[model samples]
Target: MLYFEDLTPGRRFETASHTLTQDEIISFARQFDPQPFHTDPEAAKTSVFDGLAASGWHTSSLTMRLITASELKNVANGLIGMGIKDMRWPQPTRVGDTLRATIEVLAQKASGSKPGFGVVQLRWTTLNQHDEIAMQLETSIWVARRPTEQA
Candidate 1:
């Protein structure tokens, strides 16, 4: 299993490409986030975004997959979520735009209060096949560290 020691600051990890489907987008939006831009394409066209766009939550969920496939799950410290900080959807993700995620480790600090755990801050950026950035996220997660005995 991967451990906290395995995470290197400034390191980056990427995920396989995936295309967002219109049906899937509508499905998710209909349930969790029902907004004009997310649920109705014609309304979205008249709205500012031009067409149907995925919710930020949906984008976040996709980002998690990239992290999981990157083996972050194995390295997490009980998988504690610290919440997102800055998030921006620069470009609307269309149904056919192939999407990929990349994560860059920004910081790693052993928690002073939580023994045997470390806090990791990362920037997760999602891009399309054309190399255009679609979403930007700042995520903070806890990672289990090697016990003192092992260290």
Candidate 2:
């Protein structure tokens, strides 16, 4: 089980890969984003992207899924997200792109108000098959600390 004490600055973890399919991309965009560049390939050809692209939100959702499946599933007490910062989609996620995620612990501090928990800041980067970064974000989460043994 992962705990506050186990997460150190510069620690890194990688997630399994997920390949984007055109049907899934269109389905996701049609429901959530509904933007031409994300949903309509022909329209996207005229847009800045020049081709269908997955919505940024879709990419973030995929990243979350990968993180949960690969890393958080084993963590004891689970994690509570505090907040996200500096989220950016540096490159478009297009159909047939295989993506994976990596996370690095940036900093951490024991919570003063909640002695049994700590706040950890992490930098998350999602990369495509070619190792090009697709999305990046920084977020903080509350992690439980190991219980202290009574004297």
The candidate scoring highest on TM-score is 2
Q: Please report how far candidate 1 places residue 11 from its true position, in Å.
A: 1.4
Over 33-84, each residue of candidate 1 has an lDDT whose tens digit, in order, gives 9998999988988877878888877877776776677655666455567888
Instruction: Show the colliding residue pairs in model 1.
Output: 77-143, 77-144
Which pairs of residues collide in model 2? none
Q: Which candidate is the best by lDDT?
A: 2
Model 2 steric clash total: 0
Once fitted onto the true fold, the runs of candidate 1 whose alpha carbons sit more than 4 angstroms away are: 76-78, 148-151
- What is candidate 2's lDDT per residue for 1-151, written digit by digit as tens? 9999988899999999999999999999999999999999999999999899999999999999999988766666776788999999998999999999999999999999999999989999999999999999999999999888999
TM-score of each: 0.89, 0.97
TM-score of 1: 0.89
